[model samples]
Target: MQVEYQAPLQRLNTFGIAARARCLVRVRSEDDVRALLRQPGWDWQHTFILGGGSNIVLAGDVQRTVLKVEIPGRRLLREDERGWLVEAGAGERWHDFVVWTLQQGWPGLENLALIPGTVGAAPVQNIGAYGVELQDRFHSLDAIDLETGETFTLHHEHCAFGYRDSVFKHDRPGARGMGLRGRALITRVRFWLPRRWRPELSYQDLQRKVAETGIQQPSPWQVLEWVCAIRRAKLPDPAVLGNAGSFFKNPTVTAEQCADIIGRDPRVVHYPMPDGSVKLAAGWLIDACGWRGKTVGRAGVYEKQALVLVNRGGPQDPCSGGEVMTLARLIQTSVYERFGIRLEPEPVCVG
Candidate 1:
């Protein structure tokens, strides 16, 4: 375990906002996490877990101990006639894990290529792209209870995963559920991947790319490359420019509500949600509001993708000077004005 006080979090988070943490600890092992949790004088209310920090935004200084989970390892635990059970540490970089699986000829994660964040955070959000979700291949995960310092194994059912949500998101505290709000910290994740290839080309971009390339069935590597290309084109690279891939999740509304919104704006793009609802494209809504490439202070919507909010360099005040929150509010207000649907932010905000 590595510990530091008054740590600068600007370099830690992908958003490039410079916020100071009261204290920070990097746990490289499950034991480290257990020991840290067992320590006295650590306020449970003022503690939080962080992974790659790719899906978070720092609103101001964090008056808490930011636990950076860095435990790292990967192993093939079991294989059967159906598929292989691959286990990875929660702290492993998501893209690296996908590359490792692809290099091993494992199928299932190719569609999730180039997604930013850690493996631990994947299950929390049921991260999905190119028509594949983490829950589809998730086997189980190990997490530690913050209060008791006890470790528990959670299966798919226990996770209670939904579209961009899980037990970690909606479950009530102390309510017979794996509530994500400051209750448990994910340590390791297991994925069940198939040996045989079953390529998914349902996403419009994937379908268009395959058709344009004239490939009947592309290999997993080819699929990964194409997805990477698409993501690179659509989402701003956090390394080059500070920004989360997508600030807001696509809004899912009832069929009747969808019809009403489309009637108001015919150009609205809609996807069929799994639960008989309609998922409206947030980018389309934002672009329709003429928010693309619009700048406010140092924050602005990305030129190519309206879903992304970029922190254009300007004044140095990390908390107030940046325009991210302003732009996000603008998007939310405009979308709400144009359509009745509310846009929920995907990134966790810390202060």
Candidate 2:
């Protein structure tokens, strides 16, 4: 474990919010985490866990100790007639891992290409893209209990995955009567890629790719390329214009609410869920509210994709987390007032 005092965090987060951690500890392995926990007067309860820093908003200087997970490894754990079970350390970059799986001949994760953040953070957010959620490919995960420093494993059912949510995101018990939020530090994740794979082309972008390429039966690699291209075309690169991709979750509404919104604005982009609900396109809503390409203080909505909020200012005058949240709140309020649906922020806010 390596520890630093007053660590600069501007470069750590994709949003480019200037902030500092009172103490930042780089935990490279499970042993490192145990060593840190054994330190005298160490307060696990107050420590903030940081992954790839791509899915967070630093609202202010973090006063608590920051545990920057850096554990690393990836390997094939099992393979059978059913499929391949692959495991990856928490610190591995998510997009890299997805690409690696594809390179190794796994097919299920191709639809989620180009997503940001680390493997450990995927289950926490139940990260999804195109047409597949992490839960769809998740096998199991190993995590250290922050409170006891003991390791445990959880299968798919224990994760209680929901739309951009999981046990890791809640402190209170959910419908499943269990929540692991702030209590567990994920160390490794396993994915099961079935041998019997089919293209996930439910999303319009993938369908368009099919239309453009005239390839009805695209391979996993081809699908990955299409997803990456689509994402690059829509979302700005974090290195160029700092942003936490897809600032808001696509809000789901009841069928009645959908009908009401449709009555008001027929062009509203929506998709019917299997559960009889409707998922509204958050970007479309924001764009309709006239927020696309708009700036407030140092934060601005990305001109190309309204779902992304970018830091318009450079490093020296980057957008403060306050400015970002202010703009986000404004957008949320306008969206709710217009559509009678609340827009929920996707990133976790820390300080």
Best by lDDT, which number?
Answer: 2
Q: List per-prediction Cα lDDT, in the order shown.
A: 0.85, 0.93
Predicted structure with the largest TM-score when compared to the true one: 2
lDDT of 2 by residue, 70-172 (tens): 8899999999999999999999999999989988887899888889999999999999998899999999999998778889999999998999999888785
Report the error of model 1 at residue 92, Å.
0.6
Model 1 C-alpha lDDT versus the unseen true structure:
0.85
Q: What is the C-alpha RMSD of each candidate to the true structure, in Å?
A: 1.7, 1.5
- Lowest summed lDDT across 10 adjacent residues in model 2 is found at 170-179
lDDT score for residue 267 of model 1: 79
| lDDT value, candidate 2, whole model | 0.93
